[model samples]
Target: MENEMRSANTEPLHKPLGSSRTFPHFEGLLFSPVQLVKKSLADDVPVDIETKIGPHARRPLKLSMPIMISAMGYGVALSKSFSIALARGTAMAGTAFNTGQGPVLKEHRDNAKFMVVQYHGAFWRPTVHQLGQADMIEIRLGQGANAGAGTVVKVTDLPPDVLADFLATTHEMVDKPLKELVVPPGIPEIRTQSDLRQLIHHLRLAGHGVPIAVKLAASNYLETEMEMALRAGADVIVIDGAQAGTHGSPAILVDDFGLPTLAALCRADDYLRLNRRRDHVSLVVSGRIRTPGDMLKALALGADAVYIASAALFATAHKQVLKPLPFEPPTQIAWVNGTHASDFSIDEGADSLARFLTSSSEELKSGIRALGKRSLREVDRSDLVAWDSEVARITGLPLV
Candidate 1:
């Protein structure tokens, strides 16, 4: 009877309709594996720091500082502004930066010391050629802010200069109004297991010999997915937590599906360790990693390095003076009942990000000194403690 029930449950889940335009549904919403993992664990620990992925490696990625600016993507953050901010900030504090998806602006590549270029689409220059340009190649399966939903892009996210550059490149007619910016999702054919294997091969074959990292949201059976990634040649895996913020995402998908950052880290670590590939790859955590304390906590919970995004933007924001947007009117569209917010004072937005980058970097460096660590790699689980392990246990975590 158990086998019979299991068999029944294994049937094709909400098969896609025969019609191209028609969609299918299980219960009118997307099905997620988070609901199952949430119910299975117990004894969650606040400090389960244990080196798991690529454990036997000689040295881990010695991120100068414990923090990084998680790439919010090209269209989400003004062209190259975020990267420039990181270059200055990371150089000051010492850390890595992510080259987010979307159009790869030239300026983003200019100053990046340790840039992780994300392969978002089929069109991305394969990692083989990009190895010299980036230290790490992060495979973005999904983001915590949206899980497997969509990438956020509004005209307001681009700087006037960048938009001008883009316009010239595409040769499309004229000014895009603040209210009429059409953020088109770049069409790509690179979202499959095979696609990942090819990219991994590219990274390994690159002249610079960069390590490849695959990123995923805590939306499904992560243990299962991560194992596949390891088998597919992943040198590192990034598990983005739900608390990770974004310019915008559909409320349902954003709020639903995926474990919080801490929870996902625990599961992924356990899986990698148990699989006996701990030394073969590494685990990095991301999503709202603002302070040294946050990075400290994540490391104590088994993350090799904690990635950040919003925090970096805070460092690079322009001080007070905002740049005005040239686009007269920006177009907007509603996706999944979610209205788009497009304010085109692009310069103002850039100014804020540039200023933010500076401030946040200083704050992070202070935290590192307080911890008595000269570099990010020196800070470990032993240097920190979880203040709320009991509360974590209440969430059904597997206590050590």
Candidate 2:
């Protein structure tokens, strides 16, 4: 069906949702539980699921659990109501919410406990005051779904409020409103390592010492990119793998580019360790990480935390998807341009998402206790074993 659609259209097939392709994930990896030799933590024993990103930074991003809500932009991706729900939900769960490649929505900042603002390659730049409000600043060079692809949103398509915000934040005054807003593939100011270093320095100063993160698509040149980002003084590095979700990315880019999450995480972990920089900079990995087990496995393999978008979106919508069921797709309730977007209930969505995060965190704590560990920091590669030989080879874990 997808191939038929591609054949019919001259333009690249634009998938309105995430990638349909399946990548090798953490399913082949199993956690090693303790029983006889090493005793598991008692049921009553408290487990600390707290996580700190960019620990060495003056203002590290601290969360109650090792899960964060990944970037799902307002206007471009999610509706205003959905974005605010995500903010409230993350706050309720005691985690952080990221303002994606869209205009900074004041409501998101107002409701979120911790806000990570993306410094993206878009026409509109956040004001200095907006930067100061961030818990972390993520420089989005590329993402797993689209890599360096640019986005073009027709001005007429944007909601009135979103359009106003965009015009207000634009760097220069336009005699007339732009016909469209184009977000470039790369930051115009950053052409070299030195340029990146300077930008990070400037952001650090502007953000009043908050962590400066560099988010990159997990690629074959992962190590080289990591080196450049580290040299630029990035306090945290986010490796978004091939399985990462996107609102609207071309089918070819979604299916044919980037490394899988498990491979990317292992390679990144090894690079950081070998260079003795693991302790200095935090590592956050995201891509098809849905369940608590996946999150735990990511942490064991050396990710400081995990980010979730698809999962969070589903959780937020919960049974409310019935509103757009049968006739319309479920995402129509949450997407910015969706037919039923205005019908989305912010309070209900927030509650549902918060419950999901809390439940997932509890499950992670249970897994930690089963491993005879009381804290997330105690989890390591040794706590995991691979069922597949290929998985074993990639993760350096023994095969059962």
Candidates' lDDT values, in order?
0.53, 0.90
lDDT of 1: 0.53
Tell me the spans in candidate 1 whose CA falls farther than 4 Å from its real position. Answer: 1-62, 122-131, 152-195, 318-390, 394-400
In model 1, where is the ten-residue run with the lowest total lDDT? 16-25
Query: Each model's TM-score?
Result: 0.63, 0.98
Which candidate achieves the best lDDT against the true structure? 2
Q: In candidate 2, what are the lDDT values of residues 1-400, reduced to their tens digit? A: 9899989988888775457776667999998878997989887899998889989889899899999999898877888999999999999999998999888878988899999999987768677889999999999988898877777777787778778877778776678758888888868879999999999999999899999999999999999999999999999999999988898888888888899999999999999999999899999999999999999999999999999999999999998899998899999999887888989999999999999999999999899999998999999998999998889888888999
Runs in model 2 deviating more than 4 A are none
Residue 345 deviation, candidate 2, in Å? Answer: 0.8
